[model samples]
Target: MSPVFAALKERHPNLRPQFYMSDCADAFWNSWRAVFEVEGVTRLYCIWHVWRAWNAHIMKVVDDARRSQLREMLLKLTQASTPHAFYSLYNTYAEIMNSKEYMLKDQNKKPRSLANTSQKNMSSTTVANCGLVSAAWAQISLPTCT
Candidate 1:
């Protein structure tokens, strides 16, 4: 964030940074209003923290099959033009992968590492790069003129 701001400042020498942002939520909200009041820019947290949080549940539900499905889902469902669609797909996939059946897949089976099986090779479908979503959301967003 700082680097981007610095580059922007260098290019537009008239611009000035009003505040710094860390991951602290208190600091962000408390200072955000002041920063935007002084300059039009507001500092905030990136998707990294959100992604980390969502992935914790993903690791639990991950198996080989679900992992493949997740990768493909992210590839297909995420689009810049439709943030709603992207988020909807995420919520839907989260539901499927976190279902009772999926969650209980290992309760009865003994933990065995099979090198060539889906059980061993799969990651959860939930672990995805937020950049994909961000890029997809960058294009003219779909109208929700409601």
Candidate 2:
């Protein structure tokens, strides 16, 4: 990847990308910074990967109805076209996830609250650790790459 980036840079010294879309991989990000050297590039993670990672954790929700609801909320979040819409959906999701009705049981059947989880893990940042939806929507009106 570094060699490819180096070659591209060598071929087009003026080429600078505004946005880069990739899966949530540390190596890819590192290469993008260290090798690509595009100062203002906005890194965007694949929504599919983010959804899959969140789905894994959401599957642990004890109630099937709540689990399905959470999935729908996540889908809506990813599809949000504006920052306001994204944040509104996110707040609703957070409210429900933090509610007592959304409790998860331990191996001993003890109720466990996801409230103890870090905000980063509980929110959309769990997988990508980046504000994927909000950031992407913020740039919705930007000109597309040719």
Candidate 3:
């Protein structure tokens, strides 16, 4: 990957991407950063992968209706047209996760907060990267690459 990036740079000295999207892989990110260290590149994770990971957590919701609501909220967060909308939806989702209304029972029948479970499964870095991707998309109108 570094060699390929180096070749591209060799061919086009002015080539600098404003955004680079990947599947949230550590190797890809490390390579990208190594190649574009001084460039202001907004790293983005694939939205499909992000949604798939979050869906696993959403499926754990015991209440069907609440689960559906959470699914919709997550979808909205990913599909938000603007950074402001994304942030708003993200806050609402976080609030719901932290609230007592979103609870699951342990084997002992004691309630456990979904917030803890979610935070355990999904790191804050993933959420922050998603926001960066959303913001980059909102600010640019780049042609889609195959």
- Say which candidate scores most in TM-score: 2
lDDT of each: 0.39, 0.52, 0.53
- The collision pairs in model 2 are none
* Evaluation by lDDT, superior candidate among 1 and 3: 3
Tens digits of per-residue lDDT for model 1 on 6-61? 56556776655532324424444454443334453333223344234334534656
Measured with C-alpha atoms, the lDDT of residue 78 in candidate 3 is: 57
By summed lDDT, which 10 consecutive residues of candidate 2 come out lowest? 107-116
Model 1 bad stretches (over 4 Å): 1-27, 34-45, 71-80, 83-91, 94-146
After superposing candidate 3 on the true structure, give the runs of residues whose Cα lies further than 4 Å from its correct spot.
60-65, 82-84, 100-146
lDDT of 2 by residue, 58-110 (tens): 56544676677767876776555555776787667656655744434321221
lDDT of 2 at 16: 82
Q: Which regions in candidate 2 have their CA more than 4 angstroms from the true location?
A: 100-146
Better of 2 and 3 by TM-score: 2
Against the hidden reference, what TM-scores do the models get? 0.33, 0.63, 0.58
TM-score of 3: 0.58
